[model samples]
Target: METRKGLKPALVAAAVAAAFAAPVEARITKIEITSRGPAFGGVEFPGVGAYERLVGVASGEVNPASSNNSMIVDVNLAPKNARGNVEYKFDFYILKPVDLSKGNHRVMYEPPNRGGKTFGPFNRTTGGNDPSSTTNPLGQFLAPRGYTMVFSGWDKAAGTNTANFNATITLPIAKNADGTSITGPSYEYIVMGNATTTSYNLNYPAASLTDKSAAKLTRRARIDDAATVIPATGWDFVDANSIKLLPDGTTFAANDIYEFSYVAKDPTVNGLGLAAVRDWNSFLRFNVTDDSGTANPLAGDVQKIYTYVLSQPGRLLNDFRYYGFNQDESGRKVFDGMLQWIAAADGLNLNLRFSQPQRTQRNRQDQLYAEGIFPFAHQSTTDPLTGKTAGRYDKCLASNTCPLALEVYSANEYWVKAASLFHTNPAGTQDLADPPYARYYLMSSHQHGTGNGTARGSCQQLGNPLNANPTLRALFIALDQWATNGTAPPPSAIPRLADGTLAAAMPQSGMGFPNIPGVQYTGLKSTRFLLNYGPQFDSGIMTINPPATVAPFFDNPANGKIYPTFVPKTDSDGNDVAGIKVPDVMVPLATYTGWSLRAAANGGPDGCEGSGQMIPFAKTRADREAAADPRLSVAERYGTFGQYMYARGNSIVQLMNQRLLLDEDAYAEYTAGLAAVRAGSLLKDE
Candidate 1:
């Protein structure tokens, strides 16, 4: 094939072309391109000229009998094709340079987070879902460097493919050996509505909507509160998939937790979603054409590949490696490196019957789902509770397919997502070391979501304004270098039990928190429980819905706490003492914290889910004395605005030396810090 117009062909194609020719197994039967056009309206991206966008559906089959797929629940029960293989189809979106030969010959696949494109974090832009335009601008960081960005549908619940809701998959429904519909207990957690709200949609269809005895509804004021059952007569199902109050004009109180348990039918071979990703990446890397002769869009254009997943999809990547999906059908590695943000140590409920991959464990919600389990670390460590000896990367490690992995968590994850388990033993007694291929970093004093520099109150206290964008941009580049070359990224920077940085959650002394006025430090954190999902849990069938769990508190002699949790000890300024101290934390304008409490109107005392706090420092020493604030005032510390900027610049230089802050991002950080200082009116002698 002749090179495309304006593409400068390179020798990298010949180097990897041999691998494409050596592929022997084929799972992707057909690829149908639905739309093809220029991306960003043919906007030139500096060194990399105009880019092209292609939207399509890729259909494939998986052999249930293969060792690579046998662990999937009900794979044998799924309807098969003529050759006895389970079939699946997923939507895909590709944005690459118009002339591939001149590009970097690398692919970056971002699995959609709830069917929504999440390239915003990496691109430093937000707003639109359509990634092919400046509406959700693809900032100069990713595309300008000549990367081919890709996205694909992996979750059926993510809904249909549209401009806003793209990247969805269709999987075959699982059935009994005799082809009967499979039924099991499914759970739906709903946050109640206000006066005008009437009903909510269920995740799955109820097998018998009218069978009141088979369905149960319960309400609780808090996650740990005892459940109060609502009589079946009190509420009725509007249909097989929605419910509402019993009497007209009746309504549920806003922010209350409601749980509905019912018999649900037709479990899709949801595990096929993993196979869909594996094979899709394999097709792009090692195949020139599909069974239908549809040419691989980037046929010889891909050499190395990486994946970036945030939040819920981040947990999916953990499950993807746990289930051994990293090894493709032809025994080839799929992703070369992966970057996960805010996932913490959580697992996805993606490989089981009636799996709800969308559900995640949080402080005040979705705590009972099977999202937090054993094997929380990448390296094998025996669980003290379950006595299981396994790791997230065991299967891939044994198969020699473990990719270089980096997990970055914000302070919010520690409070709500059980992030400490990633480094510590399951008992949280001792810190475990990461293997050579893995590194973990913490974004000090940040929340699950980024915030603009401000002290606006959202939950109870001021919202945390410590953004991780600059640091993450640096780490993303570091991760790519670690995969592309043999360059080692920065060492892992997290709080340690051995050091004083990692401390007990309770008691202000343990956390080194100052007595900031109007701020409450309850030391509230999401606790983990060893849940019993019946004997078949090891086999991927969670027979128990809302499974029974052990007591939240324990009298154990060794640890004294069940799955003990810890938070980063704060400095006198209430910023985290450990982890990568972003400019906001290193040169502080406020007391940023990982934990925030809900307002009394919402739900008192409990954590405002995945939120952090930002309490600004007093502008002068007189203000600090008047407020009785123990920490020094901003004026007392920096004296002048220029002095503050000078200190922040030094910190940035140190981070750059550690390779945690890229040179390009330093200018932006400097300007943002300067603007924030001026906004707070912390100038000298003002």
Candidate 2:
């Protein structure tokens, strides 16, 4: 194969971390393109010419991320590669340069964000089946530059329909040396809707049983809540392979979780799910072809490769890096650069016997498992609670294949997730220097989901309407520049305990918050601690049946291995002061919080999961006097469009000066925010 694409020097990530690696090399067997078309309804890309979206299947044999032989279930599976040769179909969208000379022959692997149908991929901003021609958040701006955009999914438990969902890799079943099927305990937390639906999909196949009584199913209102084991729980076999909940005497309530531990058979090798992303991208980026039969899709046309996975997929990236999957089997690196947003403390729980990559740990509801294990930060950390030292990068560092990376977080992580532990010690300070190859940014006063500020007053407070996507958009370009061209990104901005920006959290008072009548403080924050989920948990071999947990699993005040929880400190207005202070924080509009109380209809009022709140300031002093609001009014802060625009302008300029806001985003925000202020939307009369 003649090389049309010039050979680029393999960029060593160690400059940010340490060490030097060999130059980049690539290969692929062949590419089978099925169908091609214009994406985003013919919105021409910026630098690249018209986009050509292609769908096809790729097959190859892959090794484990490490020497972890457990991912290959059958001891007698395939001798070619113990993990076996598998084919996974993928739907990819790319652009071929009209003028190849002017294009940048690079590929950006956009991993599918599979957190249900909403967070899945389609190149839409809100993320659904609909593709946005008007507004696509897929960072489509990279398309014009002659970059090949690729998206492949990692969740095996998802539906097999590739047109509607992401691609899935075919995994072989694992068996013992004696050929007898190996079975283990597995659990499921099914969210309720009138309880008549008794059947739930097990993370893995329950060990085939002649008698249904061998399995134990139970029910609980919440994850940490006490449970009542269902003795009368009946089961209807959906085939010899699957089972359904046989609602008999059991009164399954609405919106509650029904759990079951069974002798599950056919434990899917889900850990290979992460490897599928790593291996597929690796094959496409580097390979002419080996006996594995992987055909390069855009071999010579692509020079460099980068991946960006948001929320759920971000967690998959973390899981990927955790296992040293960054360095492929051939000793070549996969992603040259990566961006992980809203990952929180989640490392994908893939490698388990009955792995379900979609098990998200929401507060007071479905939180469980050991994916929230030790060694979260890139650097090694010593757990004060357990005296065990661990790091997430040990494997990556060993192979010198670490990718230049960025981590973006919303305030929701701090108040509702265990994200504070990423920077802080177990029992100590809330700030630490970021690792060499990565940068972490906290988007202050932002929320991930839709919110109604006033419609759900039953919640602890109003929901936060702000999102950090604007800032994420700016940083996305910065990451590309830094990865492709070696341009340094802006310094990370996170809340610090040393600077008093981040401190301990409290339920209600002590933050100098003004008492807003009728608005109840959530009086809750998500707990984070190192947990002992029994012996076989982390290794994906569960020994404690049903579910294994420590004594403090249900205790609200229990601390984990090393530390309690830490939160961003707040100002007198009850808004956090740390992280990237965008226009909203610099210019006054509403006092936004990283936490929101779920309405009775939403989260049942306890700890309303991880939602943010927005508390708008009074319009005028007259309104404050009538409402008896103690906080300063919007009019008191700024009068008219001129005043608001002046402050907003200054804030944007200051953020730009501080390198917190990119110049491009700052300018765009100035225009858009000024227009909003003029239209009386941002700074309102009411």
Candidate 3:
């Protein structure tokens, strides 16, 4: 009962404040109503109470404990001008002992009904057709419940700005049942869009309407179609030799130069030109000059570089050569040399280079041999000094002076090296580790020239052959994490298959050798043959024509012997040759399922089982029936591949853009390259 005494004065003060704040503007202001109140006060405006109790208050009655009742307020704001065509209505509730200092407690209001028709534009339509009736009974029921409501125009010109609408509603609180004056908080509401000039006098007829305009709509392109079409405005392919001088006569000294080369194989279509390759070269550049116009090359300098090298001259563009690397040993030495020279001449470091070779060849006798086809073929031959095979090499083989080590360097390695240099220890320095890069990954069982091996068993069926090397997934994850997080990723975070679980571990070297009959040496051999040795001995021996192609043979399919036979074929030298046998390994591609299969599998009265085997197989009759159905759409067949591609491409672009923003030097170079491509002058005229 003591609580009632405290509420009366608070309600009176809130009412006084609302009366003063209402007339400051004649135009309506929008307000959002919510059921909850701000901290510090339990009071609500437009208080709530029983109908009889409120009636008693209107007649100046008294009830000491009545402060606990709720009150409802009807807000009405009439346009001041005689020509005013809009009226604002607001309804809200107030809790007992209202706090005037805090804003009014607000409640959401529903629109009113006119002749059984809802007042809003959205309620008038149904499924591309006009509904048979547009009546809203809910709105009509609230009208006689002591609630005030009105129709108003959301006109922009009537207000100071385009955002604020021309009209609003205001509610004033009066005395309550106990002869105690009730204070009401101020309230406002505004809607979006322009309203026509019209007045309603309760009995006025509804305005004539036109066909309602629809909201702007956008449809996603077909996924398969999108994947097949080349990008129109974003990055495309470029050429290795496409770099040319800017039309504005920007000349570069030998030291100011950057060269990027790569062998790009056009797997899509062949014979592309400079024009077709320029789109991808467009990029943003930043940070080459200081405030005083001095040339300063900090770690962040950025520029866009684009170059593509096809299999043949003037052919379709395929791969890219982006020349942005750290000044380290693992990167192109020639490029680093050029930058040093440029820095000495221009007082800034400007040298950078990147290259991609279609295939690298190496001399077998060299101490630091470039890993080529031959070493792999001869991997079974062991060196007496070291217990390891001659062809076996580790990550640091090139620097270790191993005679059998062959390093097939790539441009991606240089990018990784550059990224590591900028982000890792000895921060901001260009010095990079030897081989300044990481490992080269060969995927197992992947298709479309990706690699051969089973990457994961979870997606495998009965016939799929599992890949032995499981660390490939981890390497890629590491690369992405390194690019995203500055911290060097630990090998454990990379995904790998250990036992049955997906785990992370270091990548193991690929073993290429296969044991064959009569090949005295055994162990890992090259996946592909490198050479054809002549079969004959010395000339002084008895004159007998020698067989051609003296390569070692495994078991003869006919006799199961080591002897070579000309039955398969013979070369010009008359040496016997055996037919090459391609491996017939069955690799798992992807799995397909239907909605019907899912429904049937989960249709039991009991809950679904958690065991892997408990899940039904696709070969079930129900699954087959679902597959045979013709009504299934092409989208159903592809699963989410299209969506996945779109998301992946977007992610790649986002990452590149973010990197461009962070690295000034790289961004500048990228922008310059883009500009050259845009001007149709990236390639030399000759």
Candidate 4:
């Protein structure tokens, strides 16, 4: 590995210098062992002989010499693995890694929830949740090839941890040169607070928390337009965290943004979340002296680092790269490769004043601030709507800090996640092609994920039961080979401009989504509002008082900026036509969609905030006719239960041949799916 330009003088440890030059300034100062146990249930980690799980915190400070002495990052690393150590690369998460230069040349990861749900290698109170073996299934095979597992925390606001996967961060408060505390404007859009509900709270403490008289609130029914400021008599702050609406709770409607202006105290440069990861990875990979006041463990043996991010964390990756955090302070690079899952061209809402990184483009009812903005592609292109053009990787590429990237998405992204804008122009005339440095895929027929879903008691459709984790596992392997060995991953499966498969900005009725009985369909899509968080926002401090909201003409489809909301063409079953088609969709177990409507009773009809729906086909031809299912029943389509099984088996073979499904996992999933289908007795031969 060659050193990129800016960090020419980095101090590389003897071990690391033996291979390549790296940056200096930060290294893991202390490896606090909270718990150590044999990894993989005490079984050897395949190629790595006997590996042990070293659970603890890797504490230290950033190089005061390379950076400001004020920032000391204490990363809580849960589960650092080791054995006789045949070389290992730090396979890490949504945003942290311990040592980079120690072992193998490759690594993988999954940052599940709010950057805190990173549980791997630990037998949980729940059960065996090993992604490689079960959940994702990529690890089972990847383990044999040699990749180290790593997980740590970057978010200071992450919730309490569960079991062995506990993590949180400590951040320094930001202040001015005068030593005065920083205070600024912040806002919140409660997804669904009870309108009449008294004592409603804010996401962060407010200057008006105690003084109800100063609390000012404005309301917006939608995120794309101006909000009417409610008179002071319209609302009252009940306490530090509580608020009440006048006239009645109903005054607070679903999907409304309640803009409040308050001077927030003790601002933590939360954007430091990116900086912490940058310095930490540089420390690990280069073995440079760290603010930690310690030695680098895996210094020389490190080859390349890879990051695999999920959903929210995926957005974190988007911002991390967009902000140029990949180029560490010492001028070393952080990741050599990255896997972004379902981010939908959006970066984290974090990094700004009082950031709500945990929030998202709340379907149709809330603000879509950072989720849809500039740098929609790997190679920055002119914002057809804004006229500003910059690639997300421009800085990284310039510094040679850019990593090979693979992006995966769900069909839901096109439906409302703003995924369409990636391929189609704001005006919706054509599709955008991907750059050579990255590959993008839409895991069609799925939603954000199958978790966080209920029985659809709030909706008419049955909840989506499909998990695309299986597809992710296979792609992870492909990405690994591509990054480590230069074997290009499969050509991305996306709707193309030349192809007629690309559809855009279509009203609900135009997409041709069927109206299944009892199933709700709402025309509402997630709002991709263009927000100006005031001028100082980029400086990590918001200066605007009650930030103004407006929808530019380019954003309005009626005006047509040429940036359109696009989705892939679908087959008669309504599943997307592109990407790695899963067996469940290929074999037609049911109608699996990336889009579902919220039941009206549930304050919906807006896309079910973020879950797809699964409608089971009829069991028999008679039942199909009775239900008037537009698609034929599985039995009718395949003739018999045995026939359906055979067809599913064949589909698995096709997927394997196409490289979408590896031979090893394909058979296992096929057998399991067959057994389950048999047990459920979905279709029988007459």
**Alpha-carbon shift of residue 340 in model 2 (angstroms):** 1.2
- Candidate 1 vs candidate 2, TM-score winner: 1
Best by lDDT: 1
lDDT tens per residue, model 2, 552-620 = 444433333335667777776777777887787767577887776656564465666656778777777
Clashes of 1: 0
Worst 10 residues of 2 by lDDT: 11-20
Q: What local distance difference test score does each model get?
A: 0.80, 0.62, 0.18, 0.59
What is the per-residue lDDT of model 4 for residues 537-605, given as tens digits with 9 covering 90 to 100?
544555545433434423444333334566666676666777767888778777777777766555455
Candidate 3 lDDT over 547-654, as tens digits, reads: 111111212222122111000111211111111100111100121110000111222111111100011112223543565421222233323434323333443344
Model 4: residue 553 alpha-carbon error in angstroms: 13
Distance (Å) between predicted and true CA of 631, model 4?
1.9
The TM-score between candidate 3 and the true structure equals 0.19
**Residue 183 in model 3: lDDT:** 24
The better-scoring model by TM-score among 3 and 4 is: 4
Backbone clashes, each candidate: 0, 33, 71, 29
lDDT of 1 by residue, 337-420 (tens): 998888889888888888888777788877558878888899999987867899999999989999898899998888888799
Instruction: Indicate which candidate wins on TM-score.
Output: 1
RMSD of candidate 2 to the true fold?
5.4
**lDDT of model 1, residue 380:** 94
